[model samples]
Target: MPERLTILVVDDDQDFLGDFEVIGRDFFELHTADSGEKALEMLKEEEPDAVVLDLRLGSGIDGLETLKRIRETWPDLPVIMVTEHADVDTAVKAMKQGAFHYMSKHPNIKTLHAIIQKELGSVRWKNLCLEEIRKQYGEMIGRSAPMKEIYRLIARVATVPLNVLVLGESGTGKELVAREIHARSGRAGHPFVAINCAAIPPALFESEVFGHERGAFTHAVSRKTGKIEMADKGTLFLDEINSLDPDLQAKLLRVLDDKAITRVGGNEVKRVDVRVICASNQDLEKSVAEGSFREDLFHRVNGIQIVVPPLRERAEDIPELTRYFSRRIQMKTGRAGPVFSGEAIEALQTYHWPGNVRELMNVVERASVMAAGREVTVQDLKLASRSGKSQGFFQELLFLPYKEARQKLFSRFKSVYLSELIQRNQGNISKAARQAGISRPGLYRMMENTDE
Candidate 1:
């Protein structure tokens, strides 16, 4: 049996609330709140699939404020606003504040039930697709929308024998996506050869890609097989494809078209069945326009283009990625891994990861190894922002609720100010209190409260 969906109804009308209980009993598991304060409390406890809120409450904060607060914490949850006396201005305001839908109280309960069902239907389908991707792609550690779309694209393009071009910054896992496509395709059992175009010298580029006969050049002591030949009946991934020399690009285009390669200094042609997948951190289109990369080769290798999102764009996945790296470290070292504090994770999410996922993995591994105890704090991560300031102080507050964040900011300010004042007074509380324009006892109390 399918699990029943849950909804929270917030209103002050006792009689209408009772009627809704009977009306929605068959379709949903219901929770009721009489005021906005109670509704926010219930939101944290119940975590319902959707919320039905009244525009006006008899006491405390009204529906609009409640909706704004709900959006702050749970931005993706569906919220439908229903009022007994809905005005055009009020409905527009609620919609602007992120209400899923605004509806006036109607005589029939079926209309309200239908709206909820329609909203949740899409949410359920997305979640189901995400679950399937999770089961299949275990190496990709993200559930964000961008990652989900990439998973769907990979699934669609895996079976088709077409060239793929992956575009992303360095360390964004472009090669990982190519490998995933190869793993899911018919070429899974064959070799998945990879070569870095930028790492090879221009002189050896031809010999490295296509086999050369014995004595083809000074270094060619014997007949050698190249990456393309080694990856026969499989996938060949060329990283930094934009760095390939223009002369070699034309030759590669010819091989891709003919599905064959001719050995250097030899007449025999070799027929090979290889699917080519290329990746470039640089802009290949701009490179082609600049007369560096061949436009013909560009189109040949770019049958399908997949762009891997950078790590900074998917900050929500940092905690999961952190846990994954920690687990791997534990397995490798045969010891308990360091557990990251909540603040540490928040600091990580706020960082501008210019190096992308590979950089994140390195940071996690380093922090785990250097941690003095099992618990790793923000200081252990040692993150610095682009401005060269520590990320633990101000940037982390972006992830917290407004009230809590304000309080933390004030507390941090107090700690810094009071410590400086006391140090300037040479540890004399009386002199520090005089300078701060407060009584000595009051200064002592402030120090006690802000300690650590």
Candidate 2:
């Protein structure tokens, strides 16, 4: 049988907690905290899978304060801010503060269940090494061979503070990888702030990185902190760092050289202690050789390089990844559809995936929404297959070591069988359970075991 999820609901009102318990009992092994202080204490004893926090807790620490404290201590904990005082500002603030989602005091039970499912999507990687990735990037959702290797590399690197340069195509989630690195390293508890060098205008580059005084510029009315200063005592991810101009590159070199920054229009040099993780899609070496990027700066940030392989290379991971994307889309849209057929999976595996994982995500999302029925067909994938393209069966085997190779084949068989079971019963859980000679709970357990 599937193990029950443990959930803690914190509210000042005793009656509300009672209602939550009644509604959520079947879905979770419920725990209640009447106060934020008591919730924190209980959390220390054992962390809950999810938290339902009321915005206005009586006295001591209010919901916002408690949320801040939780983010400081356990940043990964999923929190749903429940409140009657629902305003646009409060909702935005709660989300920015890292509450999983915001809900009204009296939410539908179905909505609550949907929220739980969404929150659980992010709860993973308890392994310290992988936990670092989860803590930083939220979740790394791909069971593909390439992604598995990336996860393995993350595990290996999380313990060391190496200046990692993640190389990948533009939309391939390099920042996500950088966050994983920071989360896994000794700096996991600290901030993993990102600054896109290409996004900042040349006029504001220095001010963006090093901040400025109140009167630094004509329109500057107040003292503003820079990205680097904000990332002090934490990990600073320079996304598309190759786009940084030579002058700013020199300034960056100085910062790395002296571990300090001189704010725009400021005479005093302020010390900053931070771990730098730079990412780029450009040919950084060629750029350095061509005088567009600094060679010395390249040396500084290239201590450890991780090349994120393109999605096409790891096409075997398509099915599980498709399911993952499907689940997320389902949660987001509050409507589940476009379950992939075998031919559809094959079509996805055959695609070039020129845009890589990000592209695949978009395609899957669109296909799910557009498909007439719940089942996604090969045509839904929109990949033009070559008339005589090799099945690449042998190529799939080459990506894995012997143990993993065996496991993959076994897993594939299990997945195919499970799909057939569900299809044969027309998605009737109890009938399928009876046909498979397993209890209802056991069926759910098996479903969880397989990524299907």
Candidate 3:
């Protein structure tokens, strides 16, 4: 895509790292992360094209765990795992986990160069294709058949002032559709007020929907206009219509039927000329069947119904959705956000996304924060889930690059560990040495080497 692809080589083996960097410098913009944590931080700072990840990262998140997070965040980015864990089991695990290629430690420079180029060569064109797709979908970002049908319905209903009911799961962007319809309607010049029916308490719901008098209640100190009054000449979006209380539901039905609303604790009725748009994640028909929701109110509001497809049902839209969210993140947060790697988008499509578009956006936002100096890796995505917790020791490390992977297991061999342990003891080399089961002079020697 660019003149030279960026390659991040992460290995704690100093000699091997030096050799690899020397070999890679000519062919790529080289970056290095000795630990998985630094590698991840680098990824957020700037997204590299590919990573030469050693299977053994001594501390923070292990190599495999880091790879997993990278896939979660940047599924499309290629990761080439290099390790002395040359066993077939390890190779198979790495391959199944989506590593682009796997090689034993100390790979031939020529071979490594070829693999890196091959993995990254097509990325530029792929990115161009994605950009084209993003431009094609102006606002509604989906190409699935269900969405196509929904578009037709939107066009048909936009001009009419019919009461519209939007049905879908939570986070399916029902509110977006309502806004689109209002924007296209004749009342576009007027206000488009929205209220979440389920969010308001039952006691306050009526007063919220209908204007309230100054002395209507203890808290009612002055005349207050409600959502219905606010949308007098425009559209009133009542979200979560099923959450409206039975009594409030009846009052709302009267307003729709009579085109007027009487303020709370007032005798005079004020007329209104407004269109109503209702949205609900709960199935109003089922609620009506159970007698928990009023049938008359449902009939009054259900002049026309629009069903928004869940994200999983329309997976084709995710590419554009991710791009949309990325652009929005830049505008909203005022920062350059991470681009979705091809691997990352595929992983997102693979997910069931029970929380729908909302969850996907949340994952993207979090990934942007963790993109590092390189692109988001799979590891970032896995960590984005609020419930994500490390499943440590899931697999045996017998195939690990024992010398490097086990470095953290042996504290005396680790300079970073020595420095941190010394600091933890408030720079008291004696206590640190005692706790580390090492002589004071041994700690001093380690510190001297660390300084060197």
- lDDT tens per residue, model 3, 172-235: 8888889888877899899999886654557777787897999998989999898899998999
Q: Per-residue CA lDDT of candidate 1, range 390-421, in tens?
A: 56567788899999999987887786578557
TM-score of 2: 0.55
What TM-score, computed on C-alpha atoms, does each candidate reach?
Answer: 0.58, 0.55, 0.58
Q: What lDDT would each prediction earn against the true structure?
A: 0.83, 0.77, 0.78
Q: Which stretches of candidate 1 lie over 4 Å from their true place?
A: 1-135, 385-452
**Model 3, global lDDT:** 0.78
- What's model 1's lDDT at 377? 79
Mark the regions of model 3 whose C-alpha exceeds 4 Å error after superposition: 1-139, 383-452
Off by over 4 Å in 2: 1-138, 143-145, 383-452
The TM-score, computed over Cα atoms with residue i paired to residue i, of candidate 3 is: 0.58
Candidate 2: count the clashes.
Answer: 0
Which candidate should be chosen as best, given lDDT against the real structure? 1
Which residue pairs clash within candidate 1? none
